[model samples]
Target: MTEPSVPHAPTAAFIGASWLALVAGAATYLIGLFNAEMALNEKGYYLTLLMYGLFSAVSLQKSVRDRAESISVSGLYFGLCWLSLLLALLLLLIGLWNANLALSEKGFYGMAYLLSLFSSVAVQKNVRDVSLVRQAAPAK
Candidate 1:
């Protein structure tokens, strides 16, 4: 089988920045949760949504990458990946809508959550692209 035509590897600065964004967004969100005065259940719900969002974002990115490379991703699995990502977003929105936090606080959580998700997707793409390029390189 022919190897896929992988694109150029991600730059060090880009990769570093991707990692930094992910860590910063996630850390800030978690730290906020830790210091919030909300009930334990509410905190747990937000934390779970954050985890779920990150995972689903990564999963969706990988599936998209695989499809781009002409790998055989099942229709059902692909659909599920998209569905999970949407569900995570919907859950976050609904939770925030009914939350007792201030508008600014809700905005803060929303922006940080989105930033974390976007960075995770970028990081996953960078990882897969870099790995593919390295695999295609000739090792002496």
Candidate 2:
């Protein structure tokens, strides 16, 4: 017989989510800032978002496989991440092509950064939850 596994409390979950968000947000911000010159061209923004979407999809799949459990929260997170990235890319393109949109893009980018941060944290939490559930389940 196997011992039961412990799950994190809601408070712990909130703290963990916040920390993950902060770390991921900072990392993404730095990556974008450092690579702006090389990576922020009209087409590059779309390409970058596309790449992120693809990578996230793969990661989500791997997480599901590792957990051996279906978690709708994971799917929700990936969808949000892709949506946020697409919005950011669209705003970036508009900024490049239109002056008015350029001003909005600045603000949009900031919000997008926040969204990315939150989404990262959410995904992390969901993955952890799924893993815990899988571990706690009795052997078949």
Candidate 3:
């Protein structure tokens, strides 16, 4: 019989880049928020959106990976993960569309928000891959 395949660990460069992207995206978004001359409530809304988006993205990624590995994931939970991520995106878009910000500001927030969400998923995947590779390694 053929041996089971081993999951390869992600390269150090990839891991570092994923982390850097996550940090840069998050930091840039937060800094923009801090510098924006908006009302406190508006800033809170954007902050909450960023947090929600990141959490949902990471959760969805984990759920998808688990399903791919034949792990038992409840259909309801998986569906919610997808719904939450979509909702977060929708809310951000609607908020931006209605906000009293300039076009460049809106674009900045949108780009940073997307970057953060994407990078968070990448970071989560790298972490999971590294864990799997370590677990598959035999003790010396």
Residue 20 lDDT (model 3)? 96
What TM-score number comes out for model 3?
Answer: 0.95
**Candidates 1 and 3, the one with greater TM-score:** 1
Sort by TM-score, top down from the best: 1, 3, 2
RMSD of each: 1.1, 10.8, 2.3
lDDT of 3 by residue, 68-93 (tens): 77777899999999999999999999
Q: Output the lDDT of residue 61, model 2.
A: 47
Candidate 2 lDDT at 128 equals: 66
lDDT of each: 0.93, 0.54, 0.93
Please give, for residues 8-89, the per-residue lDDT of candidate 1 as tens digits: 9999999999999999999989999999889999999999999999999999989887887788889999999999999999
Clashes of 2: 0
Candidate 1 local Cα displacement, residue 119, angstroms = 0.2
In order of listing, the candidates' clash counts read 0, 0, 0
Tens-digit lDDT string for candidate 2 (5-90): 45653465675675676566656555645545443564355446534643454455445544454434466676665666566556
Clashing pairs in 3: none
